[model samples]
Target: MTSTLGFAILAVLARGDRTGYDLATAMRRPIGYFWTAGHSQIHAELQKLRSADLVGFESEHGPGPQGRKVYHLTDAGMRALRDWVTEPPRERPERDELVLKTYASWLAEPDLIREMFADQLAAHEARLAEYEHHEASFDEPPAFGDPRFGNYATLRCGLSYERHRADWCRWMLAQLGRSGERPIGR
Candidate 1:
């Protein structure tokens, strides 16, 4: 995953040279909102990319502060990014702490489990609202209407995932409430 993100960062830099902070900010703009890596993580990954010769850096003079080291993607980085995008994604390891914790608490503290579900429901509701905002902004199907289909697809995925989460959370909360076991919180 780090390698993949490294390639993405490099690809962004391929457009033009940018400082570490600038790179991090650029990542979160529209592309980063969906495929996000933290600032520290981006910095670390940039170092790794540099060591791998996927990117090169040069110090540039600036007005408000000291000179900054700006990175540019190398030819190797472009090839790497292309290969990664074309190749099949590797299987992701499953290690959901929330699911494990919910299972662990189910027998001993069912009410707490219910409360957790309620909390998740609230969080999902907020996410659903955001998704709604995105949906409202778009007048037509993404790929059908826009040339930037890649970004549109990413936004669509986010909307779909949030909607699914909201629906599932609502169902789970209803089931928990009807189970005759009072929730842990009022």
Candidate 2:
């Protein structure tokens, strides 16, 4: 995660001071969950950021407990983030496993394909439910330009994606002559 992806972790640190665990937890929110790095990856990237003077941390020592490091963005980190934001992004190849499998589905057993798509549909539904639960915490009709608006907007992205994925999986099942739609779980 040392390259541009590492910058994603840096962007999170820009928010405020966080321990490695806190950083990982922040990532589990809509933005981080969508483009993910595990806790170890976050820790590794933090070390790199520290080495480059982009981020700094203070160690809190206790009498009988292990020390904890709380990380914050250095001025260099802010400059780098500002610079990176203006850089044009490189386009990467699409590598979705489901799409790849669909391309070769004719060669596989029909029943297996049906089962796989069914499982995928169910997963998307579950994710949608989780996102909906998170959405409940927002103000009813969140105000424009508010901080919570950004959070709600990202949550909407996740919700839209899960809904589309679930619908696509059902469509695929129908195309394969299998019934796929299940009762929508609230």
Candidate 3:
């Protein structure tokens, strides 16, 4: 199944009845930054799911909007989600343009590379602050403290990634200084 199909299945099962727009909004809140599906993509995927009998839709009654379609996951959809979850994922291919660019330009312009690392460090710190804000305000906070937190595993993973980036940046900056290069961005 495609990523969009998997997302549609999960969205519908999480909430019993949701319009296409509602599903898009739901995706944006928790997983949008990670998954990044457009509204048109979601609508198209929903149509495909309906055609495959993996989902069902119903018209709303006494609604301000006439004949809005609310979608729900079928039994088949639930089973599909279960099967996908259990299946081992394929290896993800690495393709980071920023890293490539940094390494490519490093020999010619080491100072520029140092500046790039410094910039990345700032960006990572900003992201960590944003994650901390979400952890505090989100209805479901990260599992750092609370035992009942359901998404703690994923949250911890994100925190670890951010920490790694921050640490790497620090090490890179120290190496720059040790080399006696006129500090980056000077």
Candidate 4:
């Protein structure tokens, strides 16, 4: 079975060839928003892909002991991703700590809960700003069919998610009578 990391690696390569370092750096933005992986994990997955003939790499001089290798998806890798996309995804459990905390928030101090909301509001706002900045970097003709459309589309989703979370934080603060100078409830 192709792991999520496998697909993520292929998806990254879909844009263009990249060294392992480049792939890890790319994961920090859009992919990191959804999934987390360390450099070692990424390297291991790349080795697996290479063994399976799903990806190919060209060695180039770099800082690493084995030097750097730029990876690109093979035809098999692209086909694997396409096949995976067409198949129905298996249900997996979510582990959202915020939601879990909310579920048991009744036992926590009200003031502390309000503080948490305030902190979350600030974080989401910061993320929204970052997403907006990324969106502004897109080139012209960034329509659905444009080459940079995926970047734009993902940025939109991140923006919307952060906005929604910020709104929710504001609402919770208002409900707790701790909105302070911030306006709430539209």
In order, the Cα lDDT scores of the candidates are 0.75, 0.81, 0.69, 0.83
Provide C-alpha RMSD values for all models, in order. 4.0, 6.0, 4.9, 4.9
How many clashes does the backbone of model 4 have?
0
lDDT of 4 by residue, 1-186 (tens): 779888888888988999988999999987776667899999999999999999999888787576778999999999998788668877889887987997777767778888898999999999888888877786653777663676666777788888999998888888878434443232
Superposed Cα deviation of residue 28, candidate 2 (Å)? 0.9
lDDT score for residue 50 of model 1: 86
TM-score of each: 0.79, 0.85, 0.73, 0.85
Give a tens-digit lDDT track for model 2, residues 69-97.
Answer: 99999998989987886789868888999
Candidate 2 clashes between residue pairs 3 or more apart in a chain or in different chains = none
Candidate 3 stretches greater than 4 Å from native:
4-12, 61-66, 137-150, 180-186
RMSD of 2: 6.0
lDDT of residue 74 for candidate 1: 83
lDDT tens readout by residue for model 1, 1-186: 347688678767866789998898878755654678889999899889988888889998976689888888888887887778678887889786766775565464666777787888788778668667766776776664453555567767877877787787677767777777644453
Cα TM-score of candidate 3 = 0.73
